[model samples]
Target: MKRPLVSAAVVATMLSSAVATQTYADDALVVSSKIDTEGSVLGQMILQRLSAAGLEVEDRLQLGGTSIVREALLNGEIDIYPEYTGNGAFFHDMTDSPVWHDAQQAYDTVKAKDAELGLEWLTPASANNTYAISVRGDVARENGLETLEDMASFINDGGDYKLAASTDFVESAFALPAFEAAYGFSLDDDDLLVLSGGNTAATMRAAAQQTSGVNSAMTYGTDGGLQALDLVVMTDTKGVQPVYQPAPVIRRAALDNHPEIAAALAPVFESLSLETLQRLNGDVAVNGLDPAKVAADYLATLED
Candidate 1:
């Protein structure tokens, strides 16, 4: 999800023309990004909230990856898009930096970088992108394994367990490399059951529900099944992965036109807890409900 960020030249035009039009009511700001089911639902929720606040959504372009969306932002093709904080680190080549510990640091770093490009990084939500190794609750309880460190020594001492991992896990700094370095153990090729082309949630569900060859799978900490199927996400005692708080990044000109946007959005997105996010994700990803309807219902609840 990498792309050429927007340049200052494009943002200058947007700012210069913003002050001239009283009839620009129909001149809706554009928002565009990738279309990952659960993740997209959250982004749509943000869009829905903004639209309800009388912001015209001239168009919504559900693209394939953040790469194109970022490029669009940089060239003034789009005004805003949902961005993850860790992505800022990766895109800015600060992947190994230790400054990004919380949402605040990530926001500040992205804002500083984007400022040079005439983009503004806004407040982040409570959701994160931490990785976890999930196992069925029954299997974990039976084997007395509660965390990655706990399972590591067991696997090291000749326990036969197949690990289901994404293809990216083989090389990603935040994926397999970090896990092995933190746990002091490694999985042999035979001990690994790799699933290519599918996402972590799909792998986790397959491992949890079906009789997959692998009993354990790599996943995110806030996956819906972690509770539904009574799965236990092994703890990372050694912090090896980077923080990934999801936040809205907008062009500076857009924020200037809608200064109240962040205050309105902050109250709604900031209070979202893990349980709430998982359940909301389940509504659309599992139950097949329309994301707009789900977002509408959830936003209504905030008023109560």
Candidate 2:
């Protein structure tokens, strides 16, 4: 057979055009979340939505902590993940700034800053997974401790109790020290049972079981174990910790291809509120259901 020779430039142009019309190696969006039940559910929600919208997706939910997932997105190993607004302050070394205290300010700062890194923040879920102080039901009832201020008053009056906290809580600027300074209470090393940072389930369990004379535990606002363990989560009435509302962040490259991604997810994220999140967390963290099932159920409800 005889064939006409094609120029190298013509071949290159044809290949490029094919990729533009169809897709290339990086076409399918890789979705991921942090190693927590809430992150898993949120990640599953996004993954499901993309699937529903007829976009090809790769699932890598619950990959690791904030840093690991953020790095993966930067390196293009993954295309998108869920992230908190307050974490932007820490990731960019702007923790001292007041932007983290206000939700809109925090979102604006992260969206603007991360844009430089080829990342895009989507509409954030209304739920804030900020750390909280939860106490045993009996302790909270007897002491009338519903807020950090009440805890402070009890502390001043010589209440005997200890706190279960992670090393991060003891050291992070947005944690114990911030609470102490905000509410005028102090927790000496004598008052804390510090464990290494990871899943907070263990720390919350310690308070639930009253281990090591501990009646207080550091918890996320949506921790399902709070009610199941007969623990009462104290209100952060003083706004000590930074707001941690989560937003779906995508690699700009992915968004460029699947521009409908943000529109597909906006309503779903908007429907997530604090109480709704707690209920969802309880379904997985307490009832022991699969995150995928929980996410699927929630998505079904969205249909009706």
Q: How many residue-pair clashes does candidate 2 contain?
A: 0
Question: Going through the candidates in order, what is the number of backbone clashes in each?
Answer: 1, 0
Overall lDDT per candidate, in order of appearance: 0.71, 0.83
Residues 146-236, candidate 2: write the lDDT tens digits. Answer: 8888988998789997999999888977578889888988888889999886456888899988888999998887777777787777888
Q: Where's the lowest-lDDT run of ten residues in candidate 1?
A: 17-26
Q: Whole-model lDDT, candidate 1?
A: 0.71
Collision pairs in model 1: 6-74
Cα displacement (Å) at residue 232, model 1: 3.6
Scored against the true structure, residue 27 in model 2 reaches a CA lDDT of 64
TM-score of each: 0.79, 0.79
Candidate achieving the largest lDDT: 2
RMSD of each: 5.5, 10.6
lDDT of 1 at 61: 43
Which stretches of candidate 1 lie above 4 Å from their native place? 1-26, 100-104, 140-147, 153-161, 171-174, 210-213, 222-230
